[model samples]
Target chain A: MPLMTSLHSEASSMEFPALQAVSTEVERATVDRARAGDQQALADIYDWYMPRVYRYAVARVGNTHEAEDLTEEVFLKLLSAICDFKWRDVPFSSWVFRIAHNCIVTHYRRTAQRGGPTSEIPLDMIDGRHDIAYAIEEQITMEEVRVAAAQLPEAQREVIALRFAVGLSIAETAKALGKREGNVKALQHKAVAKLQKMLIPVDGK
Target chain B: MTEFEQRLSECLEALVQGRLSVDECLEMHPQHADALRPHLIAATAFARTADQQPSAEWATTARQRFLIASGKSLQEAMDIEPEPTFFASARVRFLLAAQKLRQERSTAKPRRVPLFGTPMRAVGALAASVALFVGFSGYTVQSADAALPGDWRYPIKLQTERVRLAVALSADQKRDVQFDIAEERLQEIEALAYKGKIIGPGVLNRFVEQTQPLVEQANDGNLDAGDAARLQQVSIRGTQVLDQVEPQVAAGAETELAQAKVISDTGVTVTRELVVKNPDRPNIVITPQIPVSTATPEPTEAIPTDEPGAETPTPEPTDVPATEDPEATPTEITPGEVPTDSVVMSELPIVEIDDIKLHTLTAGRLTLRAPGPSTGWYLDGVPESGVPLLVTMKTQNQQSFIVLNTQNGDMYWYVSAASNNRFDEIQMRLTRDGQVFQADAAVLRYFYGDAAEIPLLVMNSIRILPEASPTPEPTATLESEPTPPL
Candidate 1:
């Protein structure tokens, strides 16, 4: 019951507008300059993509510290490989997120080898802008969702993180994950269904 | 997909794009209202939580590091050579042409036969050769014009200049070509240095090698007035450019830079003497203006040892232990308020273990102080020299680790409250002798916001002891055990 009440309150307060991709012409010119080793142009690319990349990283790893480390690694790899990037049907955002995906996969692999905890959303990581009561409620709701999503299959988790958390379109998510569009849709549906079942009972007991 | 599933997907997309609210989505799909409501709420909450922006301090530091990496990557990419096949094919073509010409000349008799047998044929051959030359030569020369030392077209540029020199009928013309080539090398050095690329020794060596002869020629009074003026201009410009670029040159090229500077200075001296000898010559002005530099000044190599707004107080060594007095209290300082005047040690009771004190441990030039035995902190490993001295302490509720740079007195510490407390290994590996572990230091300041004062105070208490004479190793002698050992 508390979960339902908190969810209703959060729904009224938060907005879920779609995140727009940057203009193609400006991005293409910037990428061209970046490939030529222009520092300002490379900085521009980092400024535009760093946040979205961080969001996807945090959504996947569920830890701020790990997410920050992953973001740094992703950009370092980008610096080394940007010269070889060729424009194709895939957008630069897709290419960048692909790098993030690979980094997260590698991170998880290393953690598993060390037998460490896979995902943990710390309760103390709540933003301090809101009133105490509201912040606590929001933190609880957010933690529940993160915990539920982490229990989903890895592929399904990646689909929702890219599509919902990062605001990537289904097509872009497909390209980032190197999957078919139809497959991405299917995964998204199953993931949402599982999350709904876990967070809210279907029989309304 | 089932109809219900298809309807659910549509509602989710609509909600995400803000085209419909959750209630509106429920209204549109009345049958799937119960299923869609929770899903929409969960998706929104996930996005809200995941959309975390990095702290402003972290972002600023990360951006600086990223730019530095970009400079290094650009240097590396430019250093890579082109494919070997291109060079091999070019070499084969040159060799085959030379061999064919030699064979034709050796086998020819002294007959009066036209080379192409007819005027029309000769004209056609001439046109074909000209067409071939114009097709590739124009672009190659244009592209090679701006080629830097490590660039693939650099060889072509050098070869073209050599050909120009070979065709010059007069020594003055050849000398003029040499001056142009030397000036071009100077331009290349300035351009590469401005871009923050590593200027290899070969580049500076080439500049010195080419310009030294010109400087000697002018000094020996073997030049005309025009050539002397040109040499003066080139030498003056070289000195100005080299001085501007000295800071931007990457590490490990200092010897070559010094050699180049020496040649430029000699040229300037010789050229000035020539000018003094002939003051009546018109337009032989010695004061050439230095070009305005457009490069961003590189970051300085000095590491800031003192905190901002804090007085640089030299800590005095004390003979009394920190816990000797009952009223000795630990003072609380805030982050960036690192005490530099005196040793602020913890008042906890020091425990002596095995004739060695556990609270204070000395290694090389650094002396570290931990809280006490009750704090459940202990040294993790034997401290070593020539590397970062890692003192790791893990308690039940919190974990803290400090790395001391044995070379410098810089200290990097981290404290984490999470159960899985782990320091960044990559950052730890970046701790070299002379360089500051800037990223880790920034992280420490960010994470330890209010509570940074105590750890910093304890860390700042690490005194940089003076160097002492090495003690001679005691000789070891084998003692034979009794017959029981046999």
Candidate 2:
């Protein structure tokens, strides 16, 4: 199918690498130790997952301060609820992302109660790199994509965030969202199509 | 799924797995290529855009906070002592001794000793209890003495007050203890307000519960001269503290603060009258002059002003007798003339819904705008035991219902579409006396949209009437009928 050849051009330009699946044995051991109240294991889990959680939070909330607060709240909730975590088919990462997802939902609800605006793409997310022109181009693209993504329906937006932003597999996304894998696939397809229609004109320009 | 959707999902997965490019996927399925290209590009762009990294400094600080929080969690799980070094050591020793006794009982021969089988163990348990009591009485109580709301020691302080009240034998003794506790609550409120902390409804409720009885006693002339004098001192102190702290109180707690201010003002008025009746009473010494600027007049003004000689000179808390001639009649200070401060209920405009006037409805000390018959909102009926005045109101579409506790000021707005469980709905702490009310955004946006202002207006129109009344019964029973739609 020449899939590898076609993928290479797009893959080579990819600035943010996709999340690699953690080795099941290693993750299981760490999770088990954490469940046993091992502080080091918990710290290890936090160190490994904090950035991913922060990225997910930023994508969902679109503000650094709120994201930071949500990130901290997620970790604290994990600390309290981890003991009740049963080792099931669901991966630990999915469990952690679920916590982050719920926190974002609550954050949105709270913001709504305050009658405040939700999700403004933070300008500071644009990196100040040596290549000024490239940096500006990259910054503009990200902002445009984020602004478009924010317009997606809540379910579709969440699906795209977990699938593309957090790099969760379709199955993992389903587990985290408490949805069927088929539902996740349908939501992702709809989200991607909507984003395409919204941004295609902008991209052509 | 549509053939195109299936093809897109497959290609998207392959691309996400980093094994297939957008062009390659389209090349493999040329029929779907035109439709797939833009979607693939959008997905890729979003993936790149959403991949955000927090600043290094923030990450470092966040990690530090996470670790600290995790440590505290671990300490709590392990049940580590939060006491001083001495108490911690004593507690550790006590736990160790208990553990040793448990081990000894498990390992030693299974034999009962004397009337109390395991006499040593019983003695150990007794010793532990004694130690706990001693430790609590000595250190915990001393520390809790200064504890404010939200402090870990605050519950202990409340427990100790309950203990003091429980131990008092006579009615007068209990009343005295109640007065002391009431003063303590005022002090806690002052301390919290001074630090710009929120005075929650719980503290305000307790303060009213404690002081209301004593205020009533003085009003009814049931209190002895000594008790009346003490009531006067407390009322004065309460007035001074509330006035000083009024500006410092946080925004949401204003209703509770206003209610408390009314109680204090009422106490001041009632006690001053008692003093007037017994002018020669040794305890009728000087009471601090209330600054007219800070004195709220709602409570006093609400009383009928029909008496010819109602206005009296403000009583100065001095040692001088009330009258120059001991034989001469004392100047009477009528109850109606006592200056008091509260949110004036009369100022609230009468709201008419569907041509039905919503007049002020009084229940105990609480007065609110009674929901009009045609307003869709109904007074579901106050529980026979008059607290929390739960008035359930349904929206026009019957999609949501709000359960408002008009007494303690908790408003629970529930959307039927959200969850069946009421707890999942938006629960807002309305200001006591109904000064400020806010609606949750999710409920408003998802359901009400442009009509969000309807709920806010209804809530704002409701007012808490601050008339001095006896304490309400504690329990509540909700009405059975489901509220109808607006």
Candidate 3:
């Protein structure tokens, strides 16, 4: 109750700003507007971080529809809790990213339980033209990279998303994730190492 | 920095900057990136998915919810752009959820009460789909130059390689197939959890065995579900194990992995580990050393009773010699009291009576026509009203009045004859305490009474002052009507 009461008090004090300042300011504003019952404020908040959220979702779920819905739900969740949001402890984006990650993880668990396809056909498999230049310059190789990433161990893939897609600083991601910064950094190291090994050519070798 | 860290940083920076495209990202760290880039690419792919604007129907459906939360219909809300703030968005999200709940209420018939200790079921895939299509306009794919045809060949080649790698008839290929099968099994366990199926260690072991192959194949670049499924089917003959496992498997793997991470860690432990053990109760041997104590009953005394019916004949009286015994019972009167029958009420003298009608002089403070009624009225118990047989009760200390209105219900309290100095103090006191003053109009019949009690005035304000408080009486005696004046 104290946490909730204190959070509510802080939420009331921090209101949304119309024009953007720094990303931090934008985040504060989003939280404030969400607390104030502005549904559109939620949409705007989603719009700001959705690209990253969507990227993370797709990385884990490997489906556009699922990723999009998951991303939306994450924002919706954040919006719902806006009234009692706090800025003292953790970075807001990290928290939101954590939600997105959790949903993807849940999706994976569900589909695996159902014995659905685990080796997902890359999103490009579902639809072509992910990037026009890739299609023009080198479709075959880029497609291989996409499939290869999917083939990586789930842990490695997670590290990639936390590091690359979410752009979380090691410490922020670690805290958001309840992990040691060292462990997260190690994961990033291994994940990127694995990804690089799997996708590059060894012409000299 | 170590070579790996340095290369990883350069590669990641390039990846984040878009300077190193997916192919380039893969080129830099082929075996690693090829296995991992799919995730980032998948993310990119979903981000690029075409955005479907919410349909009018969806907005209409959400309108009622908006109305309830914001006092604005969905159409109205949508027509106006939302202000940029988290609180607003949160409200919108709640409004949306509320709308969904309302729609569900309208269309669905409720059934199946929740049971205690049961886990919550995941949202149905169909329900999830509806939420997506209705709330968000489906996945939006971007059409940037980086995601076009030039990059199409790589993924196709990868898929083709996977197909070959999965079905390769070699021993290594079979091993790869087994790993794929293992991965499929793990996925099945995951799917089970997702579908809300209960599982145990046996199922978990099977899941691990099934997923092991996939992990191996994943490492070997022999990954592709279609090929894996085909090979698994050919080997197992319609086991449909993969089909049964993948959905929940995906969900399960993520959960199990997350839970495992939460439970334990190598150096730089990731999360706090919690272990719950249900140990068996220990056996105990006991010897009876002392007797158990019992309670003793209490003693009771009883009086003798006799049944009377037939009387016996009297015995003859024999006179023994008259002797003065000191023990003889004495028949002497004790000193101070007189017998109750000797007192007489008939000796009292008669009192004079007068007849005149008196109106209520003031509220709380009652006055009667002095020259008319000699009868004293007792209020509760004490003589108060001037008219004979008048009574007033003080329920609360607040000065309440027994206002006696005339038969026609006129305000008799204001009568000039009833107005005087004695009444003024009573009114002032009653005003201080908030009590309703009323006089029983029926008491007017008592106007003719003896001069001993001329115009009896009852101070309903008896308890109004701290001094006139009634002696505490038994609660049982309080309800009875006071004895009528003789």
Task: Sort the candidates on TM-score, descending order.
Answer: 2, 1, 3
Task: List native contact recovery per candidate, as a fraction of 1.
Answer: 0.47, 0.47, 0.02
Among the numbered candidates, top TM-score falls to: 2
Per-model RMSD to reference: 32.1, 24.7, 32.3
Candidate 1 vs candidate 2, TM-score winner: 2
Candidate 1 residue lDDT tens string, A5-120:
65765554445645645787999998876764455667789898888888888999988888888988788878766755789857787888998999999999999999998666
**Candidate 1: which stretches are off by over 4 Å?**
A9-13, A17-20, A203-205, B18-20, B27-31, B80-486
lDDT of 3 at B134: 46
Worst 10 residues of 3 chain B by lDDT: B267-276
Instruction: Give the TM-score, chain B only, in order for the candidates.
Output: 0.34, 0.33, 0.18
Displacement of the residue A26 alpha carbon in candidate 2, Å: 1.8
After superposition, the stretches of candidate 3 with alpha carbons farther than 4 Å from their true spots are A1-22, A119-143, B1-4, B14-486
DockQ leaderboard ranking: 2, 1, 3
How does residue A103 of candidate 2 score in lDDT? 90
Clashes of 3: 139
Angstrom error of the Cα, residue B313, model 2: value is 36
C-alpha lDDT of all candidate models, in order? 0.63, 0.62, 0.39
lDDT of 2 by residue, A15-129 (tens): 3346655687988898875665444567778887887787788778777778787887788778767756877757787898999999998988888899997656566566565
